[model samples]
Target chain A: MEILSLNQISPDQVVLLQWGVVRITATLLYTWVVMAILILVAILVGRKATADTAISRWQNLLEVVVSSIREQIREISQDEPDHYTAFIGTLFLFIGLSNLLLIVPGYVAPTSSLTTTAALAVCVFFAVPIYGISKNGLAYFKEYFQPTFIFFPFHVMGEFTRTLALMIRLFGNIMSHDKVIAILLAVTPLFFPIVMHALGLLIGMVQAYIFSILAMVYIASVTQAHESHGRGP
Target chain B: MHIDWFVFAAQIINFLILVALLKYFLYDRIVKAMDARQAGIASRMEEAERLRQEAGRHLQEMEEKKRQLDARVQEILNQAVRDAGAEKERLLALANEEAQESRRRWKETLAREREAFYDRLRLTSGEIIFSTIRRILGDMADAALEEHVVDTFVGRIRGMDEQAQELLRRSLDDSRSEVTLVSAFELRPDQQEKILSALGPFLSHDVTLRCEVRPELISGIELVSQGYRLAWSVQRHLETLEEAFKEALREELPEVNLENAGGEDAPAQEGSRQPHQSG
Candidate 1:
């Protein structure tokens, strides 16, 4: 009745390029579609934004999303409400829009794939420490090994665990929500699919909030800890 | 599940692109709006504080002007009272002088009348004596004897009038003073009678007694006459000493502001000076 598994679409012949002991698989066409759709939405929203006149419908909706995300960012990043606004706001919008792609007929939700969530988590892992370092240079690194010399291992382990947690949480939630909706749709083409879709929207929003909140908390913990250590915010 | 390298690579590229686009475009503008809102709220709060300070300054100015006006009004009233008292004293002196002059004129008229009456009495006595002697011995030489008898009788009458005038002067002296005795003690009727009996020897005038119940005296009595107070109370002496100390402190520390007026940290007693007492 229904396909057992979802298949990945390839546009061209599978080509492998070897250069400098690096093998690169070219899936430019698939990635390009994802990029193009997101860019078109951004351009549409940006074009509708007005300095003087009332905001257009599409822009107004985007503004609400951006403002709500900005609020959470400020709350989580209590030490410097201004600092983490841009990063967390972008995280929320990208994740939200990516989750919304599941409602489309053909396109798979890009965030439901483990690669997408892991990549976002990796960015957060690097960005948080970089902000801490830039804000407080050598001292931020020293704080990771604080309390005692022996607690350094515990702190190091905490960092990896945080990254791993963020990665798994986002991946598990988004994929499960999408998979449940897909299963319900396969069963019936009736009123029940509507319920699953509504649930998907809810889960989509919650996942977006959770991901951005984790990013804010990570960045905030570093900066706040530095500040508590008598350093710059 | 096994990972597909192609799909994973594609997804990673897509994620980066999405982050880049959202960060560059959407987040920046949103943050700017939020910052603008925050700044607007902060400036508004500052404006409110400025307004409150301005209002406080204005209120202080108004209060200062009101105090000055009140002081000026009180000074004017005191000046008016002094002027009225001076005027009254001047009028009273003038009235006393007129009364003195009138009394001098009355005394002179009374002396003249008495002199005239004596002269007439001497003439009458002479006439009467001459008629009687002419009827009996028939001589005008008896007029000298009549004059001697009249002079002796007039001297006796003058002595009696002088004694009556001395008595009137003594009664006037007794009626001039108003004696009011204010006594404070927790004395029973029997104790009050005893105190009155003891005081009777000291007082020369008729005393009007006013007895008061004063629990604070503890064990002793107080007597107030005119502006003078004679108290046998330890509490009164202590209070007097306290007042003297306060006066000394006031002089030594003239700029040591009294606790209440506008100080927030003033003690309750310093702020509220109205004392409550029981009967």
Candidate 2:
């Protein structure tokens, strides 16, 4: 008999394979599953896409999703969305898809694991500087010393803290929802877990939006810092 | 919460791969199609605007051409009217000239006919008057009348003006030709002696006296010396009376222009004289 408990907060506890220190956990497996699902849908829908006014519903849906992401990126960054669409759009889709799949029986979202959240947050952490440097060159570091060098250390610490905050915010929200639903099922074992599952869906979508939006804000700050500074308040 | 380094690394790699794949398949293709659709819409709008402007220009040109044609039509009509008026005036002038020429020719014809009538009347009147006179004189002829005609000749010589007498005297002195006396009847010996005694005053010297009978003289006598002649006759008196009647007729009918009457009167005058000459 399998015993269910709330002690297992992440899918990492389940190891699918072990090769002498090379171990594949449930998080990695589910991540591959999500990736495969996204890639397959993209390929299928892209195959028949056309620029004509009359289009398939699937193409229309895909176009709506893409243009919405681009519009959001443009609004946040105050610049063209082309440079950041791939990175920002993928982050939203991956996390959004993982959270949406929560409705499936026995399915574990990859975002529920601390490792996946940390990985996404780490990616955003590095993307900010990379986009900023591409726009402003080495001069991107000058933002640290802005308003006098006295705040330099605080500015440096701000970067690491923000990255940690991004990871914990997504992981805690999704994992707690999952853990609460498990507890509710074990305790009430009735319609209450269903209601929490519904709540979990809302929280899941919000987390995805917040994560992507925060990432864009960070990126725009660096990419457009020179322009903002040139405007003189 | 425990973090697994391997899982974290693998998830990052997965996300990066996902980004690359979705960009290639979805974002890039969709964005390209949308941009192309927008460009096509803009081009069609521009083409529509150009066609509209071209249509407007063509309409304006057609209107202009129609206006010009209307003006041209009006001008042509005006010219036709002017030409018609000029033609009407020209025809009227031509008609007037023809009427004037016709009137002139008609007047000329009437004048010619009138002159011919007048000439015939004069000739007829002269013939009748002379024929009557000749018959009367012929009925009265006798030896007593012949003696009286000689005595009348003698009286005419005695009644001559000084100028006439002087002219007869000069002619008798200048000529040595015979003095000839012609009479309508044969004179008795006493009658010849009477004519000789009547001419004695005009003769400056003795000349031969010749008496000739010429019935053409009617009831008259003539004395001839060289080219000079003295005559008294009824034919002369009748010719003078005819000329006076012609003058009176011409004055009465003034519209008859008698300037050319003289040429037409010659034959009539000669015809009138023939009866007397034969008589």
Q: Report the backbone clash tally of model 2.
A: 0
**What lDDT score belongs to each candidate, Candidate 1 first?**
0.60, 0.81
Q: Model 2, retained fraction of real contacts?
A: 0.75
Interface RMSD of each: 4.8, 1.0
Give the per-residue lDDT digits (tens) of candidate 1, residues B6-43: 55555555666676776666656544544565687788
Candidate 2 docking category?
A: medium
- The residue pairs in collision within model 1 are none
Q: What is the TM-score of chain B alone in each candidate?
A: 0.31, 0.57
Least well predicted 10-residue stretch by lDDT in candidate 2 chain B: B270-279
TM-score of each: 0.46, 0.57
C-alpha RMSD between model 2 and the true structure: 9.9
Return the top candidate by TM-score: 2
Please provide, for model 2 over A1-233, each residue's C-alpha lDDT reduced to its tens digit, 9 standing for 90 to 100. Answer: 22224678788887889887777988988889989998888888888778788888988898898889999999988899999999999999999999999888778889999999999999999999999889888888888888789989998899999999999999999988888888788899989888888889999999999999999999999888867876777
Work out candidate 1's RMSD over C-alphas: 38.7
The sequence of per-residue lDDT tens digits that candidate 2 reaches over residues B1-279 is 798888888888888899999999878887887777778777878888898899899889989999999999999999999999999999999999889988988888888777667756764665576567767876776667777767777888878879778877888887896888878887777787887788898887898778888775567776777756666555444445555665775777666544454333222232221122211
DockQ, each predicted model = 0.14, 0.53
How good is model 1 by TM-score? 0.46
